[model samples]
Target: MRTPPNEAVATDTVDEGAGPERTCVLSRVVRPKDALVRLALGPDGQVAPDVRARAPGRGAWIGVDRRTVDEANAKGRLKGALSRAFKTQALEIPSDLGERIETALRQHALDRLGLEARGGMLVNGAERVEAAARQGKVHLLIHAADAGADGRRKLDQAWRVGGGGPAGLEFPEPRTILSMALGRENVVHIALTDAAAARRVLSAIARWRAFIDPDAGLDGGDAAGPDAGEQIRHEGNA
Candidate 1:
């Protein structure tokens, strides 16, 4: 999951190299930063995810799910904090705050992809995956690793045009990632990104992949999360 800095500290720690652990507000225990998303009430009094964590104002941190937030809201933790920070009791938390945040984050991620493309991040089409494989230009395969057999075959035909990946490469649903990340459309042919973005994307996929993989670890991940490295092989297909 993509988490902002620690929420327990309740402030932006974007460049804080305090090592892997930070404190959680709800639990009051230091934990991995990856476990939370920083949220701050905007000027309009709407709660949103602080993706960049640069928003000015006193921020409150929380895990990136609705249940925890709902719990905090019920208990008035957020209410008290807001009352103290803005020095007023007249504020509103949107009824659909979680959905709102999800939508915003998704849009931001998609925008970043466009920004990357505008900045010269290449996104090779179906045919280029093969070429990328032979020339080692391929850093990732952005296909629906779980698509139907015929769809996979057709895509693979185009995918192997250049020396693409191996015979049995797999992928994930580009649209799903787009929806989750709030992008333009399905992200079927994404190129590799910088280490930071790539790590975040890959980790998010791990949780998704674990849901469908029968062999997922207890933590519900397979590391890179069902990328092309693992291809399906039937008894007679070689």
Candidate 2:
């Protein structure tokens, strides 16, 4: 059976010289920065999600899951963890930290996608995406959450024909959101032609999915989640 999209899988092995790893305050598991979300205290003593992991001051790392965050809050574990991590008991934990983190992750992923578009590393439309897949030039495929099944299947088949194209990601964002990000109308599918850009997009998507549904694995291969046929819709060429 395929793994559920919301099930948290074991962290992928981190290679040497990648970066420093941190322990999750909730799970106590050491994971790479991409596998965890960072929470930092602001000057006002309020806790905030640092999705970019570049916030100043001390930060506490936690597993990317709503349950883990909720459990920590309910058991007062997050409070204690923050106190210890920041060396202060005056920190304030927001009641909606989990929701905030979810929003931040989504925005971060979209921002990266926009960057890829601006850099000319992104391609859209079924025909263009399919052509790139057939040529094995697509480093990553991103299908909108509500993309049509027929189009997705055709592209997937072409990708396989090209000796198996790179991993495909089913983004949770709807077509409208994706369209807006790429400055196009009705963007249902996207292809990342540049390897570096694809990696950046994949990392952002992995972090966002991990936070919203920790059980969802980000193996960078087949797309997973809700059925693509449920909200099928065709889009015009780019």
Candidate 3:
């Protein structure tokens, strides 16, 4: 989703230039450096969320998730945001643009995290991560590229729910998983979100970690690890 130096948006919107000069299509509210995705129009004129921001031509941005994009498209906010961002002619946004964007983003997330895992940037399981942190060898906290709501919340809590408080506490966010930029199905892992190669995830996926309730504890007002002899996903959804 990058253009060039002085270009509108090329690198996932994580840069300092992206701050204070942007607004969300769904919120219509300008916000700071939080999670947001950038999209660019393809040569065919169809729009796609430029996961890597390497697409040609001017860039158009959209907030993550399908409903927001649909809302923008319906209310002309999608075009509005684009026109305002690019200062150009009308761009044709397809009805299925959301799905296409989502698919592209998901694939990117999966691929990047899969690579990180292979490159030894990932170490799953809470106990393992806890050990790494204890050893002071943990450089980041990456959630899965495909983590669901429940899992995402748990991981978030683990980040800010530190021993003392949220202040100065480090939250593990892999670059590939960044500010919550990329997403995919059935995948959840973390990597160095600040790294150049992993910069893609910092702007997109990292911010989601902040919004979700830390610890994603549980839904029940009364419950303790569920009933006995009840398997979780290995058996069925609780």
Predicted model with the maximum lDDT:
2
Off-target runs (Cα >4 Å) in candidate 1 are: 1-22, 27-35, 43-46, 71-91, 144-187, 193-238
By how many angstroms RMSD does model 1 differ from the true structure? 11.3
Model 3, 1-238: lDDT tens per residue?
1111211111112333433444655566554423455577766666666656577787655444566666668888777667667666556778777777666655554555555555665455555644443333333445433344565455444533322111111223333343333333223434232233334433333333222322322121112222211211110000
* TM-scores for every candidate against the unseen true structure: 0.54, 0.83, 0.50
**Which is the winner by lDDT between candidate 2 and candidate 3?**
2
Q: TM-score: which is higher, 1 or 3?
A: 1
lDDT of each: 0.43, 0.71, 0.43
Cα lDDT over the full model 1:
0.43
* Cα distance off (Å), candidate 2, residue 236: 34
Total clashes in model 1, counting residue pairs 3 or more apart in sequence or in different chains: 14
* Candidate 1: tens digits of C-alpha lDDT, residues 1-238: 1112211111011213323554545655554444345567777876666644578986655443455556666778756655564566767866665555555444444555445455554454444444543343433344443434564455444434423332222333345654344333444445432323433333333322332342543122323322333322111100
lDDT of 2 by residue, 121-212 (tens): 98999999889778767766778888877877887777655544333467887899999988888999898876667666766776777777
TM-score of 3: 0.50
